[model samples]
Structures are given as structure tokens and as C-alpha cells.
Target: MEQRLLAAQALGENELLDLASQRAKAVENWLLEKGHVSKERLFVLAPKVEAATEPGKDGMKARFALK
Candidate 1:
């Protein structure tokens, strides 16, 4: 019947999608194991640099504080 054929097609599609997802996850895990993919922090805030001006006609000086 047409209904049975449609059901079989949907099941096949779902199986293919699941297999593709699993393959993708395997590749990702392999990359991580090989260190080709980095999971480190992508966004890091750098220490703020402040500019101070001496009480003279000289130019401003840059200063940084280390914790």
C-alpha cells in the first residue's frame, strides 16, 4: 500500500539522519583526541592598560598593573 511505502521511507530517512549524526560525532571526537581541535577559552579579557600624564609638557606614559 502507499501508506506502508511512505512509512518505510520515513523510517529509512530517520535511520540515515541518525547515522550521519553519529558519524559527525565520531569525527569530532577523533579531532579532539588528536588535539587538532582546541576547546580552550576563546574570549579572554586582557589586563587594562592605563595612561598617565606627568605634570609637565612631556607626552603621556603607559602603565600596566599585574595582579
Candidate 2:
């Protein structure tokens, strides 16, 4: 996830969104395959992940009340 975000930082806004979406889907699929998380749960959380990684938004720092 950190790697994905770092790569996204070097990209344009649209590309960042695309990268985030792709990474989220990849992670979701991996988790599903590994039985770490259920498909229903992944579906619910995937949007949130993409939103958090999204550029020009509030970001995870604000969401989590970070400094």
C-alpha cells in the first residue's frame, strides 16, 4: 500500500485515481484468494481504500486525525 501511494505521488490526478483503484482491486483479490477477508467485506472496504488514496482530497491523515 505504501509502495502504491509512493508511486501515485509521482503521477497526475487522473492517473493517481486509476492506480488507486487498480491497487485496491488487486489487494482485494489477493485477500479474497488468501481467505483473509470475505468478498462482502472487501466490496465494502474497497471504496473506502480508493477514497483514502485519492489525490486532492482530505486524505488518510485527516480521516484518522493525524498531525
Highest TM-score: give the candidate number: 2
Top-scoring candidate (lDDT): 2
Model 2 regions lying over 4 Å from their true place = 1-10, 44-67
**Steric clash pairs (candidate 2):** none
The lDDT values for all models are 0.43, 0.51
Which residue pairs show backbone clashes in model 1? none
For model 1 the local lDDT of residue 19 reads 53
**Model 1 Cα shift for residue 8 (angstroms):** 12
* Candidate 1 residue-wise lDDT, 1-67, digit = tens: 9667755654343454455555555555666688466645122222232233455432222222211
lDDT by residue (1-67, candidate 2, tens digit) is 9768876765445655555566666666777898577666645232222345566655342111101
Q: What is the TM-score (0 to 1) of candidate 1?
A: 0.39
